[model samples]
Target chain A: MIQKKICMLGGFAVGKTSLVRRFVSNVFSDQYQTTIGVTVEKKCVTVASQEIMMVLWDLYGEDEFQHVRDLYLRGSSGYIVVMDGTRKDTLQTALALQQTAANTVGPVPFVSIINKADMRSEWEIDEHVIEQLRDRSWTVLFGSAKLGQGVDELFLNLATQMVQRPPLSNTHP
Target chain B: MSSDSGRSLPNSPTSEGFTSREEDWTQLRTLLLAPEQTQLDELRERLDHRMVHSQEVSQVLPEAIAIRGVGDQQLSNALTPYVENGFIAAVRKSPRAIVDAIAPIMGPAIRQAIARALQSMTQSLNRSLDESLSIRGLRWRLEAWRTGRPFAEVVLVHTLRYRVEQVFLIHRETGLLLHHVATDAAVVQDQHVISGMLTAIQDYVRDSFGASPDQTLDQVEVGEWTVWIEQGSQAYLACVIRGTPPASLREDVHDALAHIHALHANALADFAGDATPFKATQPYLESCLLAHYERPPKQGALKGWILIGLIVLGVVWWGWMAYQAQSRWSHLLDRLREEPGIVITQARSMWGDYHIEGLRDPLAKAPTALVIEAGLNPATVKMEWAPFYALDAPLVLARAQSILRPPESVQFHIEGGILVATGSASPDWAREAKRLAVLVPGISQYRDDGLVTASISALLDRINRTVIHFPSGSSTVEPSERVALDTVAAILRELDQLVSQSSQRVHLEVLGWTDATGPPARNLQLSQERAEAVVAVLREKRLDKAATVVLGSVRPLDQGGSNQESANQRVATLRATLTAQGQDSQTADP
Candidate 1:
């Protein structure tokens, strides 16, 4: 059995907390309460016939709280950069946070999540955009926090990937 | 003595031997009449003399004498007859045996009687005169004092009737008055008399003096009298007549004194040194000198300063207002220049819509053509064009005419992908030209031939090549990919007219694809996420979102080889489909 820590990061009010709540608790809350500092949740699953425990660190979604992001990512096996699917500006903030995590915690597996998929009518994300980002080594996922759809599978698959290629320094004791 | 004369004298014991009874009666009558007549005659003589000598004294003397004679008229009149008689007759007639008999005894008695009468008369006359004169002088002096001329060298004296008193003398160098008292008489021994006379003299001098150097005098009081002596440039003399001497006699004394003093002053004027008593008092006289010689003029400089201040203030205020107006106008001009195209478009659209009803029938004669045939008349359709910037006049006029009527004739031309439609419709050719313009995309430059057509599909294909992609829900560029996205937004904006003509809403499909490295569920999610990211970038460019749709696929088996696999698997495809609301099918596809 192996354990992995993962971090969620994005701009304030960009669905970072909602996505984390959807992935960890398997439930969605319409009312958005801003994350205060870091909320850690654990979920166990079977990947490649091995039991894996994921310590998901949902961080406060404000650029001002970036000082504390490295601390949360200290033992993270992977990271998920979450952003509002309809906001083009928030996507930049998401990528910035991802870059920060990468530089501070060394190279780690990470995926970009475009949440709030139920708003597809107003969804502005397209294929050429995903291909363009793919060149940067970021995997993309879409989910709707309000409908509790595609929420669990996004994290479950990330845990499996982490188990297959775990970080060389798993310092968490 | 005659019995009648003896009987005339009283039978008193003291008078019985003093003189015979007849002598006593005659002497008594003579004594009474003579003394009275003599005193009265003296007063009359003084009064007459004063009248001839000084008009001022004469004016008041008659009234004074008349009042003094109130009690002694009979005695005073009887003196007339006796004076008319010979003095020799009285001496020869045994009137106490002439000088030896009457000289010693009668002399003392006559002297005493005369003294008493004169003293009483003077006291009575002067008391009344002094009171009236003092009150009148005080009133006049107070008036002068209020006018800032509280002091002077000479004053008109009521006591001397109309004559003026000289009370001040000037020091040589300073030209100031040195002494302030009358100068004609000697200094009085009695303080009370001197003080009263001094006060009257001062009041008179201060009221009459004109503050001129020529009228300056030195005055002093002497025993119930005032004396004024000319000094400096002055040659006039003044005297105050007092005592119970006849008014005529007093006038004579005053005349004599004034004449003598005038002579003396004139004679000594040249001999008097700068340090003479008169010259030492010039400082005191300076203040009373005419104001013209002492004060300087200041009005010219004061007026110039005020005028300069007013001019400066006026200029400052005018400049401030002009600057404010210029700034306000500049702001308005900036707003107008920033959105010129939008303002022009809105105006043209409104004008076209306003006359739409009249241009519905193509067979009807064009309103503009009819108006032109009727001698260049303007069309009835009202048009208003408000351009944010100054617009070309020919363009606006042509546009207005085309809106009013469509042409019937047709011509054709083609350049690049632009289709120029020009023709006259019965109503107007504007609607057909506008329709053709809307259909042509990338018509950057064009010339109208009146009829032409071009393929719009080729334009959309060109636009597609410029379209770029982003990571799903991310603003981060995948290095070297931003150029494509920028081009796409620019081309879309450029071809906005063609796009708008097909349908206001263009349904955009963003197909997100994922590499084979992820599981089915995750891959599907990733694909959808990628599709959303592309859509977001489009919306940021102000693309119509209601016209947008996203489709994603997770074909893990479709992965390519090596570096190409990541690029091919993660690629997103954009497709725009034009559709109208409530329509089951779309017309245009790209």
Candidate 2:
């Protein structure tokens, strides 16, 4: 089985932990993120007939007071940036965290998720912003953790990308 | 050198004329120094070909390393990080493979290390014990006070009072379980979750305190369980213990963690939730699953023997008491059965007391007194004796003597079922004894062969012999005959009193006889009057228990030949008799 470490990075209260909860059958509680700045969950996803064990590291949401620790992002094969659709500034935070994840783990595969898609009417993120993320050849998907929409696809897409990509070279020392 | 030569070659003119000359020059060069050029070409080819270059370097690398190693430490210093990193990477890739490859080498070294560690631990333990009351002890006490640990806990730690119940080898980076080993009796939860939580807690402590990454939370205690975590470069071992662990136990745990890290470095580094690779660490982890329970403090030999002696003494005392009670009960029962006039029917011991129920003659000895004689408490003996009359000879004779109230001169004895009397008693007593001897239960008969009556026999003889004279052909007594009749009446009264004292009655008979001086009818009438007159006088003297008989000329008192003799026959006589009260009388004549 192929194993990949996937970090979930995003802004504060952007439903990053909820999205991981919606994706993986986890034994650890969400309070781990609040306490330790990271919570790890594992799920076996078969991508294109290959069993890929994706170990998801859901990092505590970064805010003014706390920043995502680089220690948690070490050895990540890919990452996902979660943005709350109701908060446009969360999109900027997600983009900024995506940059930090890239610098920390070095050019791994990543996907952008605009969460709360079920509340489309309340979405503050515009199509242009989504378009700009797409223009960078970055994969941007819409999902809602509460509604369990696109949750499977969000994690599976990252797992498949990690499996198709080259093996990680920038792992922890 | 390759970079310098490549730069020179590029600058060496790559035009068409230069290219043709280059080939011509190469041919000319090959022809002039063919063997040398062949050697040069081979050299160039070996440098150009990756495989050939690798083979060439492989051939020389050993010698070069050997030479450089002997010359200085520079080669080793330069290669150390790469070798270390490569080793780390290899272990990370497949720890099992690395362990398998190095097992032949690591086995003895690990054993030696373990032996050394064990020896060290033993020495430390001995030292701790030796220093328990010395200066080190005072220091330990001070440490306990400073560390806010109980003195007992400190002592237990020194005494090695703990068992390593479980060991968890966890991935350092991902917080995943690498492997777990536990004692058989340990309660195990999901090791994966526990590993993650342990990592999270460590991370939380570190992050919360802003401690350096190198600093780690080493120990966690909850109730009686303590988790001691030893951090290594790639992985950390967490030992779960059930008591205050000894300092050497932590040291041993640290050694085990270090061994596991050295052995499974690559596997831990590359561990991605596939903990199966870490199974090779089982022996190491299990080794860390050590236990050092403080043995009960050794007791002095004298003290132990004293304890056993006391217990034995108690048991022996109890057994002796029981035996004594049982023996006393048996002896008491035997005595009771042997006692005369006592019949033992039931005997048993109940509730620490001897209960005896039997039939006992009232005159028999009390069983409780026998209980005392047997050296047992009377209160501990219960006796239920139903009164019975015994046929034993002594008891029967006693009964007879008690009932008859014989005089001192008379002694009663029993032979078999017969009550015999010896010596003389009053006739009243003798007669009364004859009647009442049958009342004693054991006496079936009464014998008085040797017994004599005291008074009543002589009195009877005097009364029977007395005679009263009457005048011829008259039914009256003279004054002298009356006096004689009064004396006989007094004798009769004495006999009646004696007989009355016994269960007997007395009777008297009076007879009148006539001489040949009157006709037969007149004589009979005269005799009848004389007897009636005698009886009438005796009746006046209170002798009413009498009867009259007249023998008028039919039978005279005497058969004499003269009238004077016949005149003596014309008399009133008295006869006396005695009989048992319910029987007919027997005559007594003198």
Candidate 3:
């Protein structure tokens, strides 16, 4: 049994916490509950027929007042950068946190989950912006934590990346 | 020469104005004077932010509050609400996680409280047993028998019955407590830990035996206390019980779990550490704590009243029977009085039996036999009798006459079975006669003897003699002779049998005589004349034709008075015999 430490990073109200809650308990809430610091939860999933225990650290949302702490990003095996599909500026914030994680530790496996896909009619991130990130060989998933659509697939894709990638190449921040 | 002593002066362009130490200081000054300096600029920028971002401050706030309030009452009071809010928020995030951290302290507290409760219950049960066979226990036993329950179960209930201490509803998959409730005396300090422990035990059982996921731990006995669990589809119910509970309590647990699933299945499926929605199932879970009792009967029951009634009826029946026997005896006596020749002089009763004592005729019926015939106990009837011949009036009269030898003048007879007598007799004879008559057979009663005194017929019947004598030679009646003649006339006047109705059939005979001293012819003539004079006086006294005066020859006696009275010879003795006509009256007096 391999326990992989993972983190969820995104801007404020970008469905990072909702995404973890949906993947762990298969539940969604319309009411937004603000998280402080970090809350750690655990769930067991199988990737490539190997049982992996995913220890998820749900960090506080990054806004103008509170940004992601680099200490919380230490010792993480992989991470999922979440962005709200209704806002284009939240995608910029996810990209900045991705670069910070690469510099602070080293580049590990990661995914970008464009969350709130249930509100596709209100999506603000253009298709051209998504095509540019895809050309960089970065994996991306569009999903909704509220509707529980593609939420579990998004977590499983990240778990698969941690399993196939080269091991112990970066420093444990 | 000064340069040789200290080769300090540098051969730079402005060496005279700026030495090496002086040049280093001038460059630091130059750097300080620049518009944008890297190190100093960064220090000012870091200090400018005044802790407006609370990430670093928030990390130390809780620890600061705890250290400040360590020995200060006011500070602790001020921070109490915030601490409670923080704890609640932590619990809402992960209930199972919080319970796992604090289980060591909470577990001992719950176990000790339940131990105290069970100890007190056992002590009270022992006290009641020492107090004697309690009415409460006995009544419960009877009720248990009626309701088809076991005796030991009923006894336990009346003595120290089990109570439902606490109830909890838990999520089966996550082992998080959904809802919880407890009695006032319950000691469930932490409900989340108990729920987690119960789920852990269930999982242990299932995994150890490779059982199905639906398998659950139904009952767990910890000393005198028991924990009952019931598994549902999404969640399960657990109950903590103290003392002995009946076997039927499992049904209550099952019902509560079913209702919780029915009401909140959708909420639990989406439970993201928010247990508020499951609070609606609190009442349903609490209702699973089941307790039942039976009331004891009041006073004595219907069987006691029935026994008393039977005793009263028995006494009344015996009394009625005794009264009936006495009445039967009285009726028998009345019937005996009506029978002929059955003379009952005395009859009495004692103690519901009869005592009959009196005269009874030889021909009368036996009283004992009649009592037996009347369907009574003969031993209860006592009879005594004095025998007699008869008690009729005529028979009693004849018996009295034969027994008493009264004088001829006295008479005896009977009236209404009473003896009566009449006439006169001596006093001595009358008393002796009455005494003897009373004892005579068939003489039931004795009356008075009528005997008269001084009777003339009684005197005359005894006397039968008469006398007549004449003086010498007198033809007329002498003075003494006149009374003698008068008596002769009276005797002829009375006495009907002496003066016969059939021509002087009654008779009185008389003779005449004279003395010797005269010539025969003259003496004879004088005697004849005297006799004629007696006859002539009788004739003057009106003698009937049947009365007779006889004249006969004279007779003489020896001479004594000399020849002086030769007329003595002429005195005639005349005797008259009055007899019936034409009849010889030889011996008429008897």
Candidate 4:
């Protein structure tokens, strides 16, 4: 079994862990539990009829307090950069962390999940940002782990990308 | 030197001329001869003064001759080197005079050197404190160790800790806080205010004393907060930190500034106070969140001991709980052994679960129920015993009572395999007792003939009105009405289940009514269909199996000019009544 490493990078409380748990366990909780321990989870996904085991690293949220360690992204196949749909500032943090991860591990495949899609009333991320990301050939999705919506498709597509994309060069700063 | 003499001759011949040709010759000759005679006398007197004064008077004479515009450049040039040489000779003879002359300037310089030496001594002495966890502190300790400076400095360096609370990327020229990321908030005051103040202060420092352009405020410590400022040509990154941060954070600030400059050089260089492009440096700014720390080596040792202590305590507590459980179980075993004609086959307790099996005498009361009195739940203690033929009616009743465990509201007696239960019970308890009675060994029949339900007449007489309502003419249940219908269905199920266990069988009569708005036949049909719809919903919920759904026809529920009354009339109602036995009602309640 080929085990691929992936990272869930985002700002604080943006449902990165929630989305991963929902994908791995098919369960979601309403509690806003910040992920402080248990960095990664392993789940086997069958992509293209081949079982690919995914090791997902739920990196520390990039907020005013803590930043994701670049050591956590070494030799990874890909990552999912998450942003809270309700906070517009977190988008900048997500984009910046994405750039750093690219610099650290070279550019692997990545997608953006604008989480809390169920909270349409409190949404703050503009559609133009999503459109801009889409224009850059980036896969953008809207999801709500609470409602068990779009969480599986996002991870499954990433799994497929991990299998299909060519391996990146080993040398990364 | 020559021009004046030539001009004097012209003046003598033209302006002050001689009068007669022979007399003019005599006057000119006398004038020229007289000026020569005056020069001859002055030279003779100066020669006598030079002879008396020696070379000193001659050197003074050149100086006097070198007075402004009195003599030409050549004459002044001759005296310049002479005066300069004389001054040098005098300074060489007594240099102390020059030194004393600049006493005011040298006074501060000498004192400053002494002060600097003293400050260095004090810094080395004071930095020998037992605690200071800064990069400077690290170097201090290293210096103390490598050079054998002091032990206290080593200790001091081991104690300091610092964290970068926030980093702000500000335009150097405009001082706009373009982007900021912090562990805490960036600034208590407005970021713009702080940035503007920083610019004002920087500008003031630059302009105030005409200090060197290279001079810039490097570190600003305000109480526990330290702002390490790293200025670039285009921008600066000010790290708001606490404690003394490491040198790496400064390097990080420098690297981040350089990276920002490289990326947005044009934007920062020509920044119009627009923060949009500067936001591109947000990622690099977050690198300032890195913190440097140094804790005492004893902390790890202390933590180890605490962990060991906790583990020891946990083991003790666990062993104590196990000991208590064992003693209690052994006491229980002792009591069981003391019982008459009882043989203990197997009895032990492990992991808080007790298992006991023995041959119990029929006459001795089973102590299984007594296990609960010992602060233990009897259900957790598994007890099994073989039956013996020492049976009696009272024993049979006891067995049935133990198995059924009827509520205090209920009472019952057993005769042979037939059990008669009576008293008052809520519909659920009554149903539970009825079901539980059959499970008692040797009991074939069960009865609750004497049980009187609590105010059953009140329940039957009252009609559950407006429990469910249909939209104006629709037969479908609205989403909001399902909650009320769910409650209604629960009550019906309990009623049906209770009646099934009782001697009297009861079922709900679900009726739907419609207001008189159409022809009587149509209203009747509409009302009938609505009732059927309500019945179908109830059946779908599986609330009751016994329900006699009837169409309670069109009643004029409202006067002309009111929609509320009409809506109220378009509703479902339920009435509970004793169902006929063996009627095989089409609506069977569960």
Q: Which candidate is the best by TM-score?
A: 2
Model 1 - which docking category? Answer: incorrect
True contacts kept of each: 0.00, 0.11, 0.00, 0.00
Residue-wise C-alpha lDDT for candidate 3, range B1-590, written one tens digit per residue: 42342354454567556676676755765665555456667668667876644667889899987776543334645666899999999999999998998899789868977985786678556645632355455777688889898765556455546778788887665466678888665666645546645665665566457676555578899975788887787777788887777887887778778877777877866653347788788668768755443323335534555777888898888789878876787777777776544567887776666788766665556667778777778887787878776665554554566567655556777776677777655455567876787678767677673554322233223212333445555567777767766655644444333233335443433333455655766766656666677667767877554344344444544466555454334443333333455565434332
Consecutive 10-residue window with the lowest summed lDDT within model 2 chain B: B546-555
> Can you give the lDDT of residue B90 in candidate 4?
82
Q: Per-model C-alpha lDDT, please? A: 0.51, 0.76, 0.67, 0.69
Q: Which candidate ranks first by lDDT, i.e. highest?
A: 2
Off by over 4 Å in 4: B1-590
Q: Report how closely model 2 matches the true complex, as a DockQ value.
A: 0.09
| lDDT of model 4, residue B332 | 79
Per-residue CA lDDT of model 2 for B393-499, tens digit only, reads: 77777777777777665778877788888976667678888898888788888899998665766766777787777766667678888788777765665565456
- Per-residue accuracy of model 2 over A38-156 as CA lDDT, tens digit each: 67677778876657767777778888888877767766678999999999889778878888888888888898899988889998999998899899998999988877888899888
| Best candidate according to DockQ | 2
Better of 3 and 4 by lDDT: 4
lDDT of 4 by residue, B1-590 (tens): 33354444534454434234446655766676778768887778878786655666677876776573232234544566899999899899999997888898779868966875686577546545523554445676677889785656345334447767777776664354677776532335545546545654565555555566578878778977788889998678888877777776677788878888888877665443336676667668876677554644667656866988999999999999888777778777877776554677888676788898877657566687557556666877988887563334565677777777665546777666688888666766768878887776657789888986654444444335435677766777788987776766655544554465555555566666776466767766767777778778777887545444444444434457356666677776765566567453333221
Estimate TM-scores for all models: 0.23, 0.47, 0.26, 0.24
Which sections of candidate 3 miss by over 4 Å? A1-173, B1-36, B39-41, B44-55, B59-229, B233-235, B238-285, B294-590
How big is the positional error of residue B67 in model 1, measured in Å on the Cα after superposition? 41
